[model samples]
Target: MKTSRILAAALLAVGSGLALHAANAQQAGLHRTDLLQQDIGLPGREAIQVRVDFDGGAVSIKHSHPGEEVAYVLEGSLEYQLEGRAPVTLNAGEALFIPAGVAHVARNVGSGKASELATYIVEKGSPLVVPAE
Candidate 1:
């Protein structure tokens, strides 16, 4: 009985620590600002622009979008990895294009805040992004 109680307590402590870590990660995750969005006169398609800021150690999980994405680095640097391709480091003034439906992840690998301007050509009614399974 004593051993079981000790195991329970240990589990509870680890669970609490994991909860705290998740909360902190959420606080330090990506910050995005919508810059522009407009219809391009194509049925169900729109052009959207956004600025994404990543704090140090920030990382985005594998995800995919329904449309083409183009990102331009605005400050600092990041590592972008697309499915089946080697990860590439992108610095300020550099740009990358991701074809629609490709899984990818991005991480801020610099010591300071990193930012990028992202433009998407996507269907108007679809989710802008979705996590990959």
Candidate 2:
């Protein structure tokens, strides 16, 4: 009986975590599909790649990662606002590097759909994305 109870509690905790993650993703307004995640050569670090799509006029919530990010535009134009820097716009075939822990937001500034291939090099065992204040 005790083992069953423990298993039930573990499942409940995992379920609750998933629910919170889904809620936050919906609030961000951007659709992200993770492509790959693996440990890098660097000690205690990892690399993650994701493709993010945004609807026309959609904006991503301000957030930061545990490490640096390299974003390559894959479709329509996108405007990025990074903390302490002027906003910049990029079109297909362009790319930008965002410093670690820098708060940033991306918006679909064009009239149609937009997408980006975002690659992150981050500390291992940490959350991939954290909302900025």
Candidate 3:
């Protein structure tokens, strides 16, 4: 009975670990890694940096930030659609600027995967990303 209980416990631990890994894998299609966040010299403002990776055909939902964003493509190709502006496709080493509060979407247009280094300068204490229509 003791041996059986030990075996069951081991199996349960492995099962939970696999469940956690699966959840993470699902989110790997669109991954964001924050690199830095710091209070800037400007009063009431902060600067943030993040690396975002998108699998082929993956897209970020329409969203807006409280401040300006500088998106620099690190790898692959991505298309950006900003509200009321023409969609722009950027390749590796390309970049774009997004105005504060402008709704936009980013889609991976490459054959495999795409990545971007996003830098933001925004108001402090406010949400970095807000969902937009």
Q: Which candidate number would show the highest TM-score if scored against the true structure?
A: 2
Give the top-scoring candidate (lDDT).
Answer: 2
**Which residue segments of model 1 deviate by more than 4 Å?**
1-28
Cα miss at 109, model 1 (Å)? 0.7
Candidate 1 lDDT, 1-133, residue by residue in tens: 9999999989876875565355335544788777887899888999989888998988986788879999999999999999999999999999999999999999999999999999999987566666688
State TM-scores per candidate. Answer: 0.78, 0.83, 0.79
Candidate 2 accuracy as TM-score = 0.83
Tell me the whole-model lDDT of each prediction, alpha carbons only: 0.85, 0.88, 0.87
Candidate 3 stretches with Cα past 4 Å from truth are: 1-28
What is the C-alpha local distance difference test score of candidate 2? 0.88
Clashing pairs in 1: none
Q: Which residue ranges in model 2 land beyond 4 Å of their true spot?
A: 1-28
lDDT of 1 at 61: 69
Q: Over the stretch 2-94, how does candidate 3's per-residue lDDT look in tens digits?
A: 999999989876875565355335453788787988999999999999899998999887888999999999999999999999999999999
RMSD of each: 12.6, 3.8, 10.2
